[model samples]
Target: MSVTLAVNCYERTYRQVLAPGYFPAIEQMNARTFEQVIALINNVGDPREAQDRAAALVDCGEITGFEFVSDWVPAALQHWRLGHRHFRRRPYLLDYGLVMPLVSSSEYILGWDAETVLEEPADWVSPSLDLLGSDSRVLHASLNWPPARPQDAGVEGDAVARVGDFLLSWGFSDQVFLISRKNMLATDMKTFSPAAIARHAPHPYTFEFRMESYQRASRKVRATYEPVRYRTNLQIDGVLDRTGKSQYEGFRTEALHRVEYHITRQLPSRLGPRWARNASISQARGTKQG
Candidate 1:
């Protein structure tokens, strides 16, 4: 089965808290991570769209190429003009939440958070896929929260709970997960409508939309936790600002300090990074066509 890595990187909102100088460093870190992930995708031989067409859209030292997913743009922009009190100024539901799942041809899609850095090269989901057996439909990571019965659960498990014929998880916004195309398409079909997003602004966090998707799709969905461990530099304690309030109250704005890429030796990757490799290929193709 094919796999597509759908990652969300919203730099505009993150800039709110990070110092002006930190953006350059953050851009470097993102480029490095993008390069590493591309290498891994090539090594694993997972089929994905050739990154050529989308690469040119990458901002200077930034992975903004994927921002083309804009199904939610109309509604979001209208909200912006009307001065809606959404937490995030710019949201990724158009790309990450709405568009990716609904349109991807990959049999399995991995949702990755851009702020995270992987310490080593690893095929993160292969083992979990094997163990969960062919019958399993979803594989996810754990959040730092105690599992409890969902408030509206009709059936409950120690770590799993079902509600209204659907399953709900406290996985902390699904930072990482492997989901089946069938489940995603099912959820897209059942809960969210293209018209809805076009007509009205949904929650900017996108959590409620995601949970509702999970609920409608849970009938055929059986999910398992991933087995790999990740290293993140997210400082949980003392992250609050001067007023004893978290700098990122509803969103994250921490600088990309202590990233794995910063500590590792830089190498000449075959694909380079930040969608540039594909852009080069696209440029060459255009030249040949001309």
Candidate 2:
């Protein structure tokens, strides 16, 4: 069955009057929440391995990650009505959309355009938000006075600008992504990551922005901010393969998946979605998900 998109409950209003001093509190709370979820993910397996995966990305010139906060926690999954598929379904975070971080991801939120989905752990962009730290935050910040139009997205740049500018003012390494409907449009900073920026092809000087940091300046300045913490029940699911059991009792799932990808690679003569029309790949051949 297809999942419907919910109206975003988290309003984008916080940006208009977002004061400079508020970052520490937000970051502290977010980091702690992220860490707790990481602990849960660790309990499921080797957190060190996950961390190593994140760290290794730094070496490979890519940033990879898994969701930190998950629906698996009793508290976290209070809102999740469904979970990702395994065999009989796995335990998942309640708020799988925002809290989960990438596996092997240290700072999972930071990365380039190519790396965003390419380096993302699994289904981050497809059916899930996975994190709140995205370029959309900037778009929300910018569109402060409108019902919002479709073109506003394209006319504007890809997600981050003012928000990134604000983060830069605060002195922390910041990266943001704002892709929707699969690269229909976007605006990105050249200096999103210093490490990655250095690797930019065709000589680095051409990129428009410079990467900068705030927390690393001095111990006294860093130690001054008080950290804020919030806790939510993180959903934790244990995934196990079902082996060769593709046939089960209970309710059956209709064919909701498109053979577009499969047909593209497996049968060049068949143009997936288009071919599906000729093939009549409809759910239940006539019935629908009810």
Candidate 3:
């Protein structure tokens, strides 16, 4: 059976919360390579994109090519003028969702364009997706295209294009996002009595899980990350026979399954009881893309 991923599309942009001084520099850095921009953003004392944005003010007339942070850039704007802004851009999808049995078990692929692709049909999928490793997490990758830019061409394009191609080729988004629910036995579920249900003790402050066999495509990059999930589950309220484990298993199999994904996903959230009220967006359930 094809596994349905818990989440499908993912996207991101230069959010202000991720940076403040970014507004002004946006114009200057717009002239340099995106790599140079990212380098400056990574150099802040606090390592936050906000501080690194300070470098954006370095226009052409102010600084020369020699003053960049050890090959980070050509001082954004040169002394000559804004110099045609050469922004390095790649493909990116703004929205997508997934249908997974559980948040943690869900997996989705992210294909960032690489500097190049093999002359022969090699393991592009392996190279692009291995970033997720075995552990689940949302991946928004940036592929490298090269031969050093104009000199030579690289992978087909950005992560977005590759992902779109995969989707088109597969005719569906199932395999890319695989999902499986972890069965929890009713016997194992120690439910508090109805009397204490409303005010039950908090879910003791703690959550940890062990990961095994985590792997990426190449060069062994070891990293750990928790995956994204949704808070959707079919609520069942009825007495259980508990007479036999097999019967219980059968019951679970027959019951409907509730799906979940990220917060911005299709469904809706209460969010303090005052959001999206009186709006179609709030009342809708599971918005789908044609």
**TM-score per candidate, in order?**
0.42, 0.22, 0.16
RMSD, candidate 2, Å: 21.8
Candidate 3 lDDT tens digits, 99-172 = 11211221332211111122222223332244333322212222222322364322321111122323101011
Each model's lDDT comes to: 0.34, 0.21, 0.21
Residue 133, candidate 3: how far off, in angstroms?
Answer: 10
The clash numbers for all candidates, in the given order, read 0, 37, 14
lDDT tens per residue, model 1, 121-228: 355455434432343323332222223234632112212333222233322244455566555554532243221221122232353334433332232223333223
Worst 10 contiguous positions by lDDT, candidate 1: 281-290
lDDT, candidate 3, at 8: 21
User: Which prediction has more favorable TM-score, 1 or 2?
Assistant: 1
Which segments of model 2 are wrong by more than 4 Å? Answer: 1-45, 55-72, 79-88, 92-95, 98-245, 249-251, 254-290
Misplaced by over 4 Å in model 1 are 12-67, 71-95, 131-133, 136-172, 188-205, 216-226, 236-290
35-59, model 2: which lDDT tens digit per residue?
1111112122444554454344334
Write the number of the candidate with greater lDDT, choosing between 1 and 3. 1
Candidate 3 TM-score, true structure as reference: 0.16
Worst 10 residues of 2 by lDDT: 215-224
Order of candidate numbers by TM-score, starting with the best: 1, 2, 3
